[model samples]
Target: MNLFHFSDEGSIDVFLPRVKENRKELPPVVWAIDEEHEFTFFFPRSCPRIVYTRSDEMSDEDRRAFFGATQANIVVTVETGWYERIKRSTVYRYRMPAETFELFDTIAGYYISPRTIVPLAVEPYGNLIDRLIARGVEVRFTPNLHPLREAILNSTLTDFGIHKFDNAARA
Candidate 1:
C-alpha cells in the first residue's frame, strides 16, 4: 500500500470531490500538508487539522487539546482557497531544495509509514531520491497539475491496501 502525501493542499480538495463525483476506485490514500515549517495532517472528522498559530502561542489547556486531538492516526487538513491563489501565481516559481526534503523526512518520521506521495513542486531532487531509496523509502512521483483523478484512481492503498486505523489502532 502506498501513502499519497500531497504537497499542495489546493489540489487535494479538487481531487477529493472529483473522486466522489466520478465514483473512481482507489487505494488507501492518506494526506499530509507539506508546508514550509510543519507537516499538518487533515482529519475528515475534525474542523481544523492544523492551527497557523504555534502551540506556544496557545494557552496550556488549548495546547493540550490540540495535541490531544492530533492523536488520531489520520486527519484531514484543508487550506483556504484564497491562500492557494496567491501561492500558485507568485510564490510558487522558486523551489527550495533543503526545506522540501526536511518536510519529507519530518512526515516520514511522524507518520512512520513506508510509502509517501508528494507534489512535484516540492519533489525531492535526484540525490535526495537516491537517499530515500537507500533508506527503504518508497517515494512515488505524482503530477503537479489537476492530477486528483489520476492520483486517486492509481493509488496503491485503495487498490490493494486497507485502512486499519479504526479497528486495530483503536483497539
Candidate 2:
C-alpha cells in the first residue's frame, strides 16, 4: 500500500517485501501523522514510497509538486498496465470540499481518453482525475498511449455500432 504524506520534504519507509517471499499486495491506508515521532519509514526505490504533507492544507503548487515527486520516486520502465490501472481507478480525496468539482473538470480537460466512457460521469470517478489534470499532475500514461486508443477507436467505430452509446444511456 502507498502511504501519501503529500509533502515535498518528509519521507516514510513503507515495508515492501520482495515478490518471491510475500505474495500480498500493499494495503490502502492513508496515515496522517504529527511531527512527534522519528521518521523510520524511509526507503529507496526498491521499497514502496510514501507521500507526506508539508502543511495542514495543500495548495495548488503543493499538489503539483507532490505528483512530480511521486512520479520521480516510483520509476517504472513499462507503462501499459499502469495506465490501464489509472483509468480504472483514478479517484482521489482532496482537502477542500468546493475544489472537488473543480478537480474533476480539470482531469477531463487534460487526458484525451479515446474511451468515450466518461469516468467523471460516475460518482467520485471524475474527482481525482479532474484535480490531477487541472493542477497538471504528471502521471505517465504510456500504457494508455496507442493500443488502448486504437481499441477505443475500433470499438467506437464498428464493434458496438453508433447507437450503443445511446443505448447505454437508457440503461
Candidate 3:
C-alpha cells in the first residue's frame, strides 16, 4: 500500500527514535491523510477543536489537555505491511478507517519512535504546494524516495502545518 508523510525540508530525511528529551512521555509514530478533517485536526490552529470520540466518551477539557491547543504535527501514511514487518518494542500500532482517522487525525503507531528513519525521498503535496512555497518551505518532487510514488501522489491531501525537526541535542 502507498502511504504519505508531510514534513518540512530539514528533518524530512531523518526518522525520530523517541520523543524529544524535554517531554516526560514518548509518542508513537504518527501520520495522517490529506482530507479536510484530518488536515484540520492535525493543524489544530487552523480550525476549531474536532472531537472524534463521543463527547460523553471523554470530557472536552480532557481531550484538549491530551491534544495540545496548537501543534505542528506531521502527517504520514505508512505501508502497513512493511511497517509491521519491521516493528519494534517501542512502537505501537493503531488503524482506523478514513472517516474515523480524519475525525481526530491521530494514531498510535508504536510504543517508541523508530530509532532512525532515513526517508527514501521527500515530496510536496500538490494541493499545498503554493502555501508551502509561501512559507519558504522547500517544495520539490522527490520521485525516487519511494517505489509507490504514483500511489502516494494520488493520495496526497490538503495542507495542515509544517514541522521542522531539530537535529540538535535531544533535550
Top lDDT prediction, candidate number: 3
Residue 101 in candidate 3, Cα distance off native in Å:
18
Cα displacement (Å) at residue 143, model 3: 39
Which residue segments of model 3 deviate by more than 4 Å?
1-3, 20-23, 27-112, 129-171
The digit string of per-residue lDDT tens for model 1 on 1-171 reads: 112243323332222212222224633323333333222221122211222222233455644532344433222222332223322321111122222222224423312222333333433122332333344323232222123223333432221111112222111
**TM-score on alpha carbons, each prediction:** 0.19, 0.22, 0.28
- Candidate 1 structure lDDT: 0.27
Which of the two candidates, 2 or 3, achieves a greater TM-score against the reference? 3
- Model 2 clash tally, residue pairs: 16
What ordering of candidates by lDDT runs from best to worst? 3, 1, 2
What's the ranking of the predictions by TM-score, best on top?
Answer: 3, 2, 1
**Model 3 Cα lDDT, one tens digit per residue, 52-140:** 22133444554453333534233232223222222221211122222222222333211222334444444433333234334433322
Sliding window of 10 residues with minimal summed lDDT for model 3: 43-52
Error of 2 at 171 (Å): 44
Query: Model 1 off-target regions past 4 Å?
Result: 1-35, 38-54, 69-171
